[model samples]
Target: MLTLQIYLNRITTQHNGATLDYRGQFSNSRLIVADFTQFVNDIQAALKSAAEKNIYTPPSKLFGNLRATPICLDVREQLADGLSPVEYKVLLETLMAVCNSRAVKPEQVLYHGKIPFQAA
Candidate 1:
């Protein structure tokens, strides 16, 4: 569900009757060469730590791109801040992603704050 943008900008454009979009020196290329496995780990760890810390508020990455950082979510502490739909969706998806990859089932994902959501 990550909407990646890898499009090249227009090669030519005119503003003051002159081209400004195609100057190679003025433009720089950005390649988002990502490691999928590392991305997965980053997200999984973020969500897992959130649950562990009881985070519930919407995170910065929830409505945007996720990065490798220790931005935890303490749900009990964040309920006051509330969350937008986008954040909720992202949080759910993140949790599910971590759970599925770790072989933790849905029922097992919310068990009293333990890894696997709970100890079986």
Candidate 2:
């Protein structure tokens, strides 16, 4: 049910031209879908305008050897990211136990999951 709620929120929020909330309420998929939709629309509009103006697309070296593929770095995903379950667990635990009130992060916290809310 939470997934469905997130989806509904994404559609309504986007159509209403509201900023996306990613911290708590929105799910990863919801945010991704909404962002991708907007990105596609923007690219389409730009390309259409360029075509109308007869602007030639400059050749890009984004794809190492594949000219046909528009290799955008931001959209590329690392297969190892999903393959590394242990790494993901450690990362999530580190985020959850974050206790900094200031913008800067403190070092030397033990990874045994014993971080107190306050240091002092």
Itemize residue pairs with steric clashes in candidate 2: none
Report how far residue 26 has shifted in candidate 1, in Å. 31
| lDDT (CA) per prediction | 0.30, 0.27
lDDT tens string, model 1, 67-115?
Answer: 3222222122122234334433343454455433333233322212321
lDDT of 2 by residue, 66-100 (tens): 33212110111223222133432332333232211
Work out how many backbone clashes candidate 2 has. 0
TM-score, per-candidate, Cα-based: 0.25, 0.21
**Over 4 Å off, model 2:** 1-34, 57-120
Local error of candidate 1 at residue 7 (angstroms): 34
